[model samples]
Target: MAIELAGRPHRVPEGSSLADLLAALGHAPQACATALNGDFVRREQRHATRLAEGDRVVLVQPIVGG
Candidate 1:
């Protein structure tokens, strides 16, 4: 299935979850924040957030400031 990942088209196995996508990309989940279709998905919920075709997903570095 194809979905928009980080603003680019990405393909993954069917029924792939947010966690699976992160693992597939070799990204450490703890080091970034994720969102699906413009909604923030908490780290604990990544595994349950199943991705759909054409979904917009973004994984970005978390802002750290004092």
Candidate 2:
């Protein structure tokens, strides 16, 4: 399956979930926030956040702005 990560395209394994995608990108679920096709995906949803063939996965770093 292929997903858009930060505006770029990434080809990932089929049936991959948000958690799986994060791991593949060297990111920890606890350290980032995500949105799938404009829908905010909470931490608890990671496991159920399956990536479709053309799904878009947008990951953002935790906000720490002063």
Candidate 3:
């Protein structure tokens, strides 16, 4: 299946979850914020958030500033 990952088209195995995609991409779940289809997804929900084809996934890094 293919999904829009960070604005680019990315292919992933069927039944891949947000957590699975993160691991496959070498990203730590705790290192960034996750969103599916423009809606924010909590850390604990990643494992249960099944990804569907063409789903929009966005990963945002933390901004540290004062």
Q: Which pairs of residues clash in candidate 2, taking residues 3 or more apart in a chain or in different chains?
A: none
What is the C-alpha lDDT profile of model 1 across 1-66, one tens digit per residue?
999998999999999999999999999989899999999999999999999999999999867899
lDDT of 3 by residue, 1-66 (tens): 999999999999999999999999999889999999999999999999999999999999898999
Kindly provide the TM-score of model 2 when superposed on the true structure, using C-alpha atoms: 0.90
For candidate 2, the per-residue lDDT at 5 reads: 85
Report how far residue 23 has shifted in candidate 1, in Å: 0.5
Candidate 3 segments whose C-alpha is farther than 4 A from its true place: none
Model 2 alpha-carbon drift over 4 Å, by segment: none
lDDT of 1 at 15: 96
| Model 3, C-alpha of 26: deviation from truth (Å) | 0.7
lDDT of all predictions: 0.94, 0.89, 0.96
In order of appearance, the predictions have TM-scores of: 0.91, 0.90, 0.93
Point to the candidate with the largest lDDT: 3
